[model samples]
Target chain A: MARVATGDAFTSTQRAEIDRAIRDAETVSRLEFSVYVGRSDGETRPFAQRLHAALAAPARSVLIVVDPPARIVEVVTGGEARRVLDDEEVKLAILAMQSAFAAGDLAGGVVRGVQQLAEHARKPQLRHTD
Target chain B: MAPFHALLILFLLPAGLFLVITLLVYLPSMRHSEGYQPGQVWRGEPEWFGGPRKGVEAIDETEPAAVGSGRDGGESGRGGASGHW
Candidate 1:
């Protein structure tokens, strides 16, 4: 994992992984994934809405926000992303990332979060569907 | 040697044991969820520093040096104007 900078600025490598994570999410669910890193006013609901608008992904899109200095991670999903990803699923992803973050594993958190998103977005096979 | 030495040894033992448990037992399960590798590049343009305008335009102008130069100047000018908003 890369060192955490004083601010939310990601290392070049970290930024690349984040972008890939979003892109992978888009590919799997055909939904836009936007990540915002900044401080929120100790509130998550409004921040989630703003992220949802900025990405302009379908209501089913996913938004991940990290207030690094504050050690906060907020994962929000639109209606569509919700069909496949429930609150519990999103929480699990957050929990995974949270553990990594607490362990000083920023890269690990991002990779795990993205992986969780991809897994949650996975379409059931026809056999499974039936 | 001294009482302090014995106390130091007692403290160190538990600390070492905790570290061992954390590294040997807990770390593997945590490591398993780390799915993607860091530094993996994506298909889209890289995000530039500053705001989306700076990041997006810088990425858009990466090709063709001459065009990129002109676009960079134009973008900077536009960026200056937008800052006033």
Candidate 2:
């Protein structure tokens, strides 16, 4: 039997689920998605933006940062990504995640939030474009 | 019936049943307890999933560049939302 690492924030199974959610979101959105689960260095928003800025392709990426202890969640979107995912849409996803977090479902909240963002940001099908 | 056989069935049956019931009651809770709860401070290092190659270490050293320098100017182009539980 594989020994569970008690020090980890998420178990192996939860990690797998989060990974799957990211993968699916990328496939749907054609945008990179990153999730950070831990403490914020300072103000949560700036920490999240810094993390987003560090992405290889920040202009096409979305970063979700969740600080459980601080009860803060921030979603930072890049230029191209922001075109598709407005603040209103991102706020809706945050609300979904916040409710889940309040219930102590950290992994589930992340997964759901990622999926929701991707769903909202999915490129509208280019139908009948000459 | 043999004395050992009777004792084995009578004693082991209830013991096994009790063990099964206990496991059934506790298994879900054990799974749920794995992750951090609200307002719980995390002792583990921060984790970034599907992040840049340098991972969490890069963020501290690298200042946020002019991200989203598109039609929208400065940070205004970089849109997102913040929340708390």
Candidate 3:
């Protein structure tokens, strides 16, 4: 696991990983990926909204927010993106991340979630009829 | 001019100076280098990671179908305005 700075900011390595996740999602599908981490006041909804606005994807981005200590995870997909990454798929990714979080593995959770998104987004190669 | 007042000032001066120095000299540079501005958004560009270049046509054409599958899951309503914590 990579070491992240303890402050409210993400380390360079963590940012790089996030960038990679976005790329992975883009490769598998058109849906964009963005992650937000910080302390929220009372609820995580506002933070999630802020993240959604920050990413500014073309109505097809997935925003994941992890609030510290509370251990809550919020996954939000834009209108167009929601069409491809259904609730079940999002739940599966969240479950995978939850398992990693239980083990005190933040990096692992993000990595696994990104990979799952990629796999879920993959399109099977078209078969050709001669 | 009590002894306690002298002692209190003596103790506070150095500590205050140290905090001021840390905040003024060290904190800003740290935040800037780490991209830690308040209310600032970090944008991830897909092109840098060898993904589809912005403004270019995507090679993968199955995105619409995948999105359609997600839409059919019937949880679209739940997705709106739901907070995790």
Per-candidate Cα lDDT values, in order, are: 0.54, 0.84, 0.57
lDDT of 1 by residue, B1-85 (tens): 7988887789988898899987997765454433222232212222321123442233233333322221123321110000000
Clashes of 2: 0
- Model 2 lDDT on a 0 to 1 scale: 0.84
The full ranking of all candidates by TM-score, starting with the best, is: 2, 3, 1
> Which parts of model 1 are misplaced by more than 4 Å?
A1-8, A127-130, B1-85
Per-residue lDDT of model 3, residues B16-78, tens digit only: 988998899766546644533222342322221222343112323324433332222433322
**Candidate 3 off by > 4 Å:** A1-11, A126-130, B1-85
What value does the lDDT take at residue A16 in candidate 1?
73
Residue A46 CA displacement from its true place in model 1, Å: 1.9
TM-score of chain B for predicted candidate 1: 0.33
TM-score to true structure, per model: 0.54, 0.77, 0.54
Model 3 TM-score, 2 decimals: 0.54
Q: Model 2: clashing residue pairs?
A: none
Tell me the tens digit of each residue's lDDT in model 2 across A1-130: 4233345788777999999999999999999999999889888887788788788888889999998768899999988899999989999999999999988798999999999999999987888958
RMSD of each: 15.5, 6.9, 14.6
